[model samples]
Target: MIQTGQSIPEVVVQQITPKGIEKTDTVSLFGTGKTVLFAVPGAFTPTCSEQHLPGFVQHFDEFRRQGYDVACMAVNDPFVMQAWMKSAGVPDGMRMVADGNAELARALGLELDASAYGMGIRSKRFAMLIQDGAVKQLFVEAPGEFRVSTAEHMLEAIAG
Candidate 1:
């Protein structure tokens, strides 16, 4: 997996925005400043919709106030990702990445084989603290667990 101090991989991904779906690369999306990019196994899944993504939504302002751009990525289509964020009431400017082909996950070596569950290839649940395109800190959750990658945990991580 990509480690701390490693730069974010250069891969083109799609982002959902008010204007329309836009193509963006990791460097352009996360290269400018501090960013907290959290990945979900899939959009609208139980834990993701109920807890993981909500934690970040609830603390969106806090992350921004601390000089960090917040982004959520999922191995779902741009349309579904946009719908999920809308259903979750995400604020404007919060980025929603659509890793439709699992390109980013595979590149980061964080792909999860969930074929048994019929979910196909998906991203492992994790969060990364990035600065100027390099990973500064990373929190990856164990399979079926939801502790380390939450927004509350990330807040504490940056605070200290």
Candidate 2:
């Protein structure tokens, strides 16, 4: 997994919008500003939709208040991401990114295989605090665990 002070991999992501899908590079998505890049195992999955993503959604205002642009990435297709965000009631501040091929996950060294659970190659559940396009802090969950690395924790990290 990526660590603090390391430069994250520059990868392309597809953004699903009401009109259509748009391709965007990581540098463009992250830009030269503070960002919170959170990755989930899958879109619309039990924990991801109910807990992980919603945690960020619920605290999105606080994140922005602390001066961070937020983005969520998953290994699903752009269409799936779009529907998931709508169904999950994602807030306005969070941008959903589709990494359909796992390229970004592999580049970040956070890819996880969940074939036993019927999920293909996917990103591990994690979140990072990035500043000026460089990683400043990383919060990665143990497999099948959800607690730390949540939006609340990241909010505290931002505060401290």
Candidate 3:
């Protein structure tokens, strides 16, 4: 996995917006300041829907107040990301990124092959604190494990 202090590779990821999905990249998203990026294996999956995403939405303000642009990413199409965002009630303060081709995830070395579990290549569940495009902290969950990447954990980490 890409380690702390490394600049995120340049890759195009999509962001779902009211107008439509738009292509965005790490430089545009995190180049100017701090960003809190969290990734899920898939959108609308149980854990992702019930916990992972909600945690970020719930803590979006705290993250912003702490000077972070929080975004949720998944290896899903922009349409799916849009629907999931609506269903998840993603706040305006938060953003959803579509790693449709897993490009960004692969660049971060956080891509996962879940063929045995019936899913194809996906982004591993993970989170990172990036400052001006460089990783400051990275928390990647072991397969099927959810820790370290939780919003509470990040909040606690940032608080201290």
lDDT of each: 0.96, 0.88, 0.90
Alpha-carbon deviation at 53 in model 2, angstroms: 0.9
lDDT of candidate 3 over 93-151, digit per residue (tens):
58789999899989899999988889899999999888888999999999779998999
Provide the clashing-pair count of each candidate structure: 0, 0, 0
Over 23-62, each residue of candidate 2 has an lDDT whose tens digit, in order, gives 9898887758999989999998999988889899888898
Tell me the spans in candidate 2 whose CA falls farther than 4 Å from its real position: none
User: Is 1 or 2 the stronger prediction by TM-score?
Assistant: 1
Write model 1 residue lDDT over 21-140, tens digit each, in one string. 999899999987999999999999999999999999999999999999999999999999989989999988899999999999999999999999999999999999999999999999
Q: Which stretches of candidate 3 lie over 4 Å from their true place?
A: none
Estimated TM-score for each candidate: 0.99, 0.95, 0.97
> What TM-score does candidate 3 get on C-alpha atoms?
0.97
Find the candidate with the highest TM-score and give its number.
1
